[model samples]
Target: MVRNEQRKLTATYLNGVGMAVLGVGGFAPVVSMTLSGPTSSIVPVLVFGCILASSGLHLLARQTLGGLEE
Candidate 1:
């Protein structure tokens, strides 16, 4: 049971990292495009990307604290 819990925790931690990476990846293109010119249409995508990154970071922080407590 202890080993199983550890495995689950590891999985959750990795998932949070992966989500954060994906969020940054999603934003990269939008940032590049914006550097060149106006990006009126991609505003929603940009917002989504920011939200995803913040949420992922939040998840990661929570998991980290939980792990440290354990």
Candidate 2:
């Protein structure tokens, strides 16, 4: 049980880190570039899509890990 808990915690931590990295990588550049010049309309759309996709991936990982624990 302790081992299982540790594994779950590790997975959750990794997921959070991945989400943070993805969020920053996806949006930071667009925000910086937009301030310098006209931003492409698609840039925001793509960044938002990346955020949604990353969130979905994180949820999926959690669900899969939960299933493994069961």
Candidate 3:
């Protein structure tokens, strides 16, 4: 039981880290570029889309696992 709890904690931590990276690394640059000029419009959209997609995947995976636990 302890081992299982540790594994779940680790999974949650990793998911949070992945989200942070996607939010910062993936979208921050595009946002900065957009603020500087109009040429970066599409870039921010693309990056934001990617971040959303990835975060969705992570949420789905977590939900699936939680369902399995029931």
Q: Give me the candidate number with maximum lDDT.
A: 2
Candidate 3, residue 64: Cα displacement in angstroms equals: 12
How far off is model 2, as Cα RMSD? 3.3
Candidate 3 is scored at a TM of 0.53
Separately for all candidates shown, the number of backbone clashes (residues 3 or more apart, or on different chains) is 0, 0, 0
The residue-level lDDT of candidate 1 at 23 comes to 61
- Tell me the tens digit of each residue's lDDT in model 1 across 1-70: 6755775677677677766666666666567667887557866676677667767766765665464434
Candidate 3 lDDT at 50 equals 66
Runs in model 2 lying further than 4 Å from the true structure: 1-21
Alpha-carbon TM-score of each model against the true structure: 0.42, 0.56, 0.53
Write the candidate numbers in order of decreasing lDDT.
2, 3, 1
How much is 19 displaced in model 1, in angstroms?
A: 16
Candidate 3 whole-model C-alpha lDDT, 0 to 1? 0.68
RMSD of each: 4.6, 3.3, 3.4
Cα lDDT tens digits, model 2, 1-70, are 7768776877787688658757685778577777897567777777777777777768766874774554
